[model samples]
Target: MFDRLRLMSDYEAPTPVWAPASVGAFVLSPTHLDHLGLDETLRTRLLRWQQYFDDHHPADLCGWDSPGSSQRYASEGEQLREELERALPGLRVELDLWPVPADD
Candidate 1:
């Protein structure tokens, strides 16, 4: 169940928890999920995340900007962040860039 963790660069303080960045893969802790900036209470969101990930998986995002520019990736990342924050307390995973269900 905990297989799709995206390993990110070493965090100075922020515990890396399946970041969308193209770094590495790592598992997430209850505390780490809370740090993702969810609106629900940390405790509630943690449980929600655990159950949510059980069936669904987050997908990386890559948006397109202008005719051909690097802005798309940046844009996509921002959107993903917003979705992650807004989709708290629910397993909807609004921030998945390339959302692919774990069962899939």
Candidate 2:
């Protein structure tokens, strides 16, 4: 699905896990907008992710501080959200940043 999206749109597939953080940093930078020629909708989605991160404190899936983990998770989550929106237009969706455990 990800590869297909990359082939169809301006979106680029994310790098491998072991790839350098600098690569991810570059992708998150505003310069990518000009380089990739992203549409306003995609740019808006990216900005929304930035706002979400700014408004919420980082938390782990287990609701504990795992240092850098939360930021990484949020970045990946935002990427997935953007990809989904691109793949499925007009699909209303809501995301809970602080989700409760299934046993709760």
Candidate 3:
């Protein structure tokens, strides 16, 4: 089982994992939102973020072009981190800094 969960934005599929084959680490992207034991409110927020990303940055690497949208996404990511920690105390939650330029 994974001991840590990372939250980050991505292109079609966000790879939240920090390192390849890293011990006790895994990504908790929106794709797995349905299978996880997330509260309704938290789940809804995640779903919204996913939809927002899909709509705004469908073909882009990141949603940095729109400052407002990216900021909102980052804010929501922070909230998700907190909610995930509360819901799954067993796992360590990490939220990646958002608005990271595609070039970076």
lDDT of each: 0.38, 0.39, 0.61
Ten-residue stretch with the least lDDT total in model 3: 12-21
What is candidate 2's lDDT per residue for 38-95, written digit by digit as tens?
A: 5666656655544434333333323424435455545555575556555446542233
Number of backbone collisions per candidate, in order?
8, 0, 0
After superposition, candidate 2 runs with Cα above 4 Å error: 1-27, 58-104
Please provide TM-scores, in order, for all candidate models, with all chains considered together: 0.28, 0.36, 0.66
* TM-score of model 1 vs. true structure: 0.28
lDDT (Cα, tens digit) per residue for candidate 3, span 1-104 = 45676666555554332321375344455456555667678777766666676666656544455767666676677777788778877878777755444434
Q: Counting only residues 3 or more apart in sequence or on different chains, how many pairs clash (N, Cα, C under 3 Å) in candidate 3? A: 0
All candidates in order of TM-score, best leading: 3, 2, 1
Model 1 worst lDDT run, 10 consecutive residues: 7-16
Best by lDDT: 3
* Model 3, residue 45: C-alpha shift (Å): 1.6
